[model samples]
Target: MKLLIYCLNYAPELTGIGKYAAEQAEWLAMHGHDVRVITSHPYYPAWRVADDHCGWRYQREQRAGVTVFRAPLWVPHTPSSIKRLLHLASFALCSLPLLAAQWRWRPEVIFLVEPPLACSPAALAFARLRHCKAWLHIQDYEVEAAFALGLLKHPWLELAASALERHALMHFDRISTISSSMLSLARRKAVPDERLVYLPNWADLAIAPSASSVALRSALGIPAHAVAALYSGNMGNKQGLEILAEAARLLAGETGIHFIFCGAGPGRALLEQRCQDLPQVHFLALQPAEQFPALLGAADIHLLPQRADAADLVLPSKLAGMLASGRPVIATAEAGTELASLVSQFGIVTPPGDAQAMVRALQALAERPARRGLFGAAGKAWAASHLDRHAVLARLESELRRLTEGGGAGTRGTTLEGLGEK
Candidate 1:
């Protein structure tokens, strides 16, 4: 099977969709599929193109059996709604020539990653020209999320943009998204059930912790007796991370509990400013991937926060890693939101932006070691069963193979049932 993955982000981005897309492409190649990825240079979580890739308009390289084609993208120093749109547009526009150039080496399938839904038409054109199936795997519902999160608020513009996105969505042969809630949103956009595939995000179960890092608590400056509540991942607007600072402020007198915020993003400065006065808080930069297990293992609890408006539009890809780390999570989500419903069994949920509620949840967990242990164990077990990386990718590969061999359109939504069984 020959597969072409079209995404704005790819390997070395270190977070979010890029990480997963790179993994998927490499895994397919290793499993005997001819995989080719067309993507923009790494610029995520940090939002700046890496130093070495600064001058290149285009670069092609082979990484572990996968053919990678990197296109130039306009990176904004500080991302606003319009600037971010331009950023996606830059990549989409720049990659079109490359997509057209791939006509000779016709791939069996062209899988597109959405965010820059602006590129859908280009991908559809490539698929049409190549006479192959076009698949869309959405990492974020950007159009709706923009309005819902107040990132873009003109009523007329919202209607026009949504109409355009809806039109682009209908042209794809197969549309897969990360969460059931996200799939439901796709359905609400009038995408027929037959077109939707539930391809949930997965966890890296193979990560091994370093034995020497067991003293990570002391290394992070937290005392042995302090209960560390950690928030680690991209600090962005959608994260509603201000609540962490508020919760820390509310619990500042509780010396037994400590708050640690790790990872960098546009929101990092704001988070640091907000929590600067709080002595119980510590902020760390993103650690190396190999140190993930030890870093995650050091935390007594993990914190995940999603804005109320953006909760359903995007599922935090970081949640899967946290669950796999065997640490109890405390997330801010409304009572019946998708995240709350999904995590109810494995972690504690509080209303979004509610500092008092978060403080209470943190206090409750910090005082109850037995309850924390139970939640951690349950999360670990669930991740092993549901978020296994190989199993998820194998299922995806099988579906893609069936789609291509069966002549394009899949078994009319049958993959959803298979996903449910898993």
Candidate 2:
């Protein structure tokens, strides 16, 4: 099967959607399928394009048997709502020619990863033109998330965006999302039940707690006896990371408890500023892939703070790795939400942005080594059963084969008119 994946982020971006996109593409490629990815340069979780890809030029490379095309886009140093829209628009406009270039390729499946839903219309149109399967894998519901998070407040804009999103969503041959809650949202947007796929992000169950973790602890100056509460991954607005700093400050006098904020993003500067006075707090840039498992192992507790509004809008991709690392997690999520339910299974769940509650949870876990061990074991077991990378990708590959082999049951012969455009 020939598959073309359209996404805003891709490999060499240590965390978030990019890592998963790269993995999926490579996995398919390695499994004897022809996979190609059209994405922007590595500029995520940091908001700055890598120096090697820092120009407005289209570049192509072969990564792990997959062909990747990188399109240039504007990266805002600090992404506000309007700036973010412009950023997505820039990529949508710039990548059009690249999308057109794939016309001769005639891919069997045009797989799109959404966050930058700006590119949806083009992908749908091109897929329709070629009569191929248009598969949309939503990592985040950008439009709804923006509005719910108060990032885009204009009533008219919200109406327009929501209408566009629903139209695009309804026309896709298949729509997959990372969580069941998100798949339900897609169904609410009128996507048929058969078209919605629950494609959760995967975990590399091979990443066991390793001896390198001792070396990492020493390098970070984390005392052997101190409990390291680590928050590792994209430091973004949706993360509600301010609460982490506040929690760190409140626990400053607890010498045996240390806070390590690892990763990069536009929010990093503000997070650093907030943690400057807290001696027990430390910040590290995102670690390399090889060091990632050890980094997760170094943490006695993983901190996952999320904004209440973003609770159901987006599920953190980092949670899989945290669970796979056999570490107990302290996640901020509202009751009854998917995130809260998942974390509650093996760790603690606190209300979003409640610093006191987060601190209390951290203290409780830090004080009970046996309880932490039990939670860690349960988390690892859960990850192994549900998030095994090979099993997840194999299921996806089977779906792709089914879609390409004409076995999909989604509504077909969808016209441009169905998108509410003449």
Candidate 3:
């Protein structure tokens, strides 16, 4: 099968949807399918294009049997709401020619990854031109999320954005997203029940955890007596990371408890400023993929925070890795939200932006190693049973094959509700 994936982010971005999309494309190619990706130059989490990919209008590259077409895009150093719109718009406009050009490839399936939903109309057009099935895999509901998070506040603009998103979603033959709550939102938007599928993000189970990291602990100045609560991923506005800083401040006097914030993004500066006076807090850069397992293993408790408003709209991709690492998580989410419900069995959940609540949760985990161990074991078991990258990607491949083969139920069984269903 020939597969064409259209997404704003792709390989080399190293976090969020890009990493998962790259994994999907490479896995499909390795399994004897012809896969091609149309994406912008690698720029994400940091929101600045890499030096190597700069000054290029267009570029083509191949990696691991997959062909990639990179289109030029504007990257905002500080992505306010308006700048973010412009960023997505630039890519949507720039990638049109590339999308049209793919018609000659006659791909059996044209997969579109959303966040930059601005590219959807063009993706749909290309799929129509090629007489292929259009499958939209939403990594995040950008429009709704922006509105919910108060990033875009004009009433008229909100209506316009909602209309555009609804129109784009309704036209796709198959629509998939990362979480059940997100899919429920799609249903509320009037997406037909049959067309909605449940595809999920997966973790790389192949990377085994390293031996106890004495050298890493020494280099980072982590005392052998201290307990580290690590938050490792992109630092973004929607993360509600301010609460982490507040928690650090509240716990500054607890010498045995440390807070480690590791990642890059626009929000990093705010966190650094808030935590400057605290001695028990540390900041680190994003580690290479090879070092991910050990880096995760270094943490005694994982911190996964999300803004309450953006809770269900964007599921944290980092959560899978945290669970897979055999470490318990402490996340800030509302009681009824997906993150809260999902982590209830294996970790602690607190209300978003409640510094006291977060501090209390952290203190509980710090004091009770036995409770942490039980949660960690359960999380690791769950991840091992359900979050395997190969299994998740293979199931998606099977669904696409069925869709192209004119099988009986085109969208019925594609929902991966089995994952995280408990």
Candidate 4:
């Protein structure tokens, strides 16, 4: 079947959403499905395009067996309401003509990855005109996140936004998201139970480095003999990075323990500014995806840090990669979250943003190599069984096919209650 995936960002963005969309498109294309991605020029977390990329109001490129449509867009710097609204408006307008151009083929499925913020309008329009199945692949819930982040402030505007979000969601033929929490949120918005699907975040085992330790140590310039505890991925308002900085300071001079903060974000510059003078802590910019496995794999402990406030909205996709890299995790999310539950089930957990607790947990594992090795094996085993890239992509493909195809066994056997129940 032909598939058109519409998202705000694509490869090179260093976002979990970009990685998820890229892997899905590539896998589908490799399986003989024609996949085309309609996306904006790559300028994410930083909100600016590459220095050397050429100008094009709109363009298309074939990358890794997928045809990608690039539309002109602006990246918002401060997350201001008006600036973000404009960014969404620009993409919404751009998709108008792009969708008109592709409406001829009427692709069998239209996949929407919401982020640039106006995907709802563009996707609903395309699916309405083409009369094709539109599937929402929600990485984050925008309005709720916007309100939580304090970007959308007016109470009346928030209500209007919620209504608009629900209206669009109801129009889609089928919907899928990364976590069960998100699925529940979607259902609460009057999404019929049968139209919603559970699609967890996934990792590509083939590309995940089997021995990331030595390679990561060499790349980061850490001595062949140093123990590294790494925290990579976005450092944002939702991530309580100050806790990591505090933990780094608390663990200073504690034999053989080094804390490395890899990846860039809004909070990274602040983290570096506050941590530059420290000897036990190191700050590094984000590496290319191919280089990430080693960086993640070589870690003595893979640390996940989140603000106590953000437990409901975001689930760091990098965790799966850490699991696939065969590293032991020291996730510090609060209780009642899927992350917290998973950590309790398979790894270590601590109160969100508790520096002293994090330090204590790291030191305990450091003192016991057997437990560290056991956790590492457990993580890899769980990841292979559930979050393996091939299995996840195939499962998604089957779900999408189920939505488009006329007949098949639906989500009856699955924990999902809504999807296929229609």
Question: How well does each candidate superpose onto the true structure, as a TM-score?
Answer: 0.95, 0.96, 0.96, 0.92
Q: Residue pairs in steric clash, candidate 1?
A: none
Q: Give each model's whole-structure lDDT.
A: 0.84, 0.88, 0.85, 0.76
Best by lDDT: 2
Ranking by TM-score: 3, 2, 1, 4
lDDT of 4 by residue, 61-179 (tens): 89999998888876666647777788877877776677778877789888888764466767777787777888877787878877777777889978887887877787878777776
The sequence of per-residue lDDT tens digits that candidate 1 reaches over residues 280-391 is 8988877777777778877888999899988788989999988888778999887777789877787899999899999998999999999988998888888888889898
Off by over 4 Å in 2: 409-422
lDDT of 3 by residue, 1-422 (tens): 99999998887878888899898999999999999999999888887888788725799999789999999889889998888888888999999888878867789999999977888888888777778999999999988889888888889988888888987888998898988888888888888867777888898665344664445656788897789899988998789999999899999889999878889999999999999999888888887777777788888899999998897899999999988878889999899888898898888999888999999999999999999999988888887777888777877887798789876343443333365231
Model 4, runs deviating above 4 Å? 54-56, 206-212, 219-225, 408-422
lDDT of 2 by residue, 171-225 (tens): 8888888877776677677788767666788997877667898888888788999
| Candidate 1: segments with Cα more than 4 A from true spot | 207-212, 407-422
**Candidate 3 to truth, TM:** 0.96
Clashes of each: 0, 0, 1, 3
**Which of the two candidates, 2 or 3, achieves a greater lDDT against the reference?**
2
Better of 1 and 4 by lDDT: 1
lDDT of 4 at 51: 66
Sequence-dependent TM-score of model 2: 0.96
